[model samples]
Target: MNNDKKIRRSRNRLIAGVCAGIAEYFKINPWVIRGLFIILLLIPHIQFVTICIYVVLLAILPAPKGSFFENFRAHFGEQGRAASAEHKQRSTSTSNRRIIKDVREHDIH
Candidate 1:
């Protein structure tokens, strides 16, 4: 569990990770934070303020390592990244990539 008080953006962000980071810091589900934000955003008077705060937090919070391009090319999302980081620090000697004889784009179910 996250024990530190410092809040940083989560890599599994839907948008900018502001809500996810806050929820992570507090050890709560990210949806709760997102839901509250949505509720606040629906209010006529608070819409602008809510958006501004979210933008500010988005700008202030730091993104995790691996540049944007690297992450774009990454095979996994936040959960995979975190699990690999904590449990598997290095690639095993036997690790290797499997080559596919055929490749095509189609709908996956």
Candidate 2:
């Protein structure tokens, strides 16, 4: 077993991914951490402390690699890559035409 695990926020987070990061580090389900948070919050005196801790963890934990949009798009497969390639091909072919719309008199020599 490799022991070089780093606790970073997960991409599959419902919120800030603080709980997910902790769960991942401990090798447990993210729901377990969520459940614990909820349970702690249910207690009268602990609610405020729980919220504070969650906020602190959210601020402290590092985000996962790639932007949120990138991660979200990844779930829909590689359609973006294929579309970008097609767009490039189309753009190049059209750009080759080089339409001279207007001949300007002020030519800088």
Candidate 3:
């Protein structure tokens, strides 16, 4: 028998994987759970409440360990780390440029 503990799925997730996790835990199709959520959203009176519940579940669920994206990144060794570093560098450069531009504009006034 499968373990009863529920963990968020990383493979079949559209958002935070709450529905996928629930489907896996209950041995049901993920699509069915998604469809049920859609139906709940269509109800006028319960739509906001349903969205809130979904958000709560998303926040509460713990992601599965070493799941799909993490495994893929691990398989590529240093590539993921390099990409992350590059992204950080780019963001820092952009912020610096913005600060410099603001300073120049202030000096002009």
Candidate 4:
């Protein structure tokens, strides 16, 4: 029921919705942005440089916080949130093994 014009999160995008979000914002076809980038990439002099700059800008520019990552992640499965949480838990536990070991030792008393 969400009537917002935000880009569909289920669709793959180049960079955190930079192309899709803008297209949605302007009510234009997102493919146009993709095509423009492709054309820019085909340019001889500044293709690589332009793409890099666009990527950098996309990463730095905030796009409604979890709006970008979560939306993209949702496409994976119904358990996307749970999977992400479990992955985070595993990573943190591995990284904090020393701290966990110390706490366990103290608790042995």
- Residue 97, candidate 3: Cα error in Å is 41
Off by over 4 Å in 2: 1-3, 68-109
Candidate 4: tens digits of C-alpha lDDT, residues 24-107: 666678899778877888989989897897777576544553565655645665587778999889887855565434443355
lDDT of each: 0.80, 0.82, 0.78, 0.65
Model 1, 20-107: lDDT tens per residue? Answer: 9888888999999999999999999999999999999987876655758337536456768888786665454345546588788899
Q: Would you give me the overall lDDT of model 4?
A: 0.65
TM-score of each: 0.57, 0.58, 0.55, 0.44
Worst 10 residues of 3 by lDDT: 98-107
Clashing pairs in 4: none
Candidate 2: global Cα-lDDT? 0.82
Report residue 66 deviation for candidate 3 (angstroms).
1.8
Give candidate 4's TM-score: 0.44
lDDT of 3: 0.78
Residue-level lDDT of model 2, residues 1-109, one tens digit each, is 2379777788778987889878888888999999999999999999999999989887677677686744775765488888889888988897566788778788688
Model 1 compared with the native: what TM-score? 0.57
| Model 2 worst lDDT run, 10 consecutive residues | 68-77
Sort by TM-score, top down from the best:
2, 1, 3, 4
Per-candidate count of clashing residue pairs (backbone under 3 Å): 0, 0, 0, 0
Residue 82 alpha-carbon offset, candidate 4, angstroms: 26
Tens digits of per-residue lDDT, candidate 3, 1-109, equal: 2686656654578987888888988888999999999999999999999999998887676557777655664667588788899988988785556443444334554
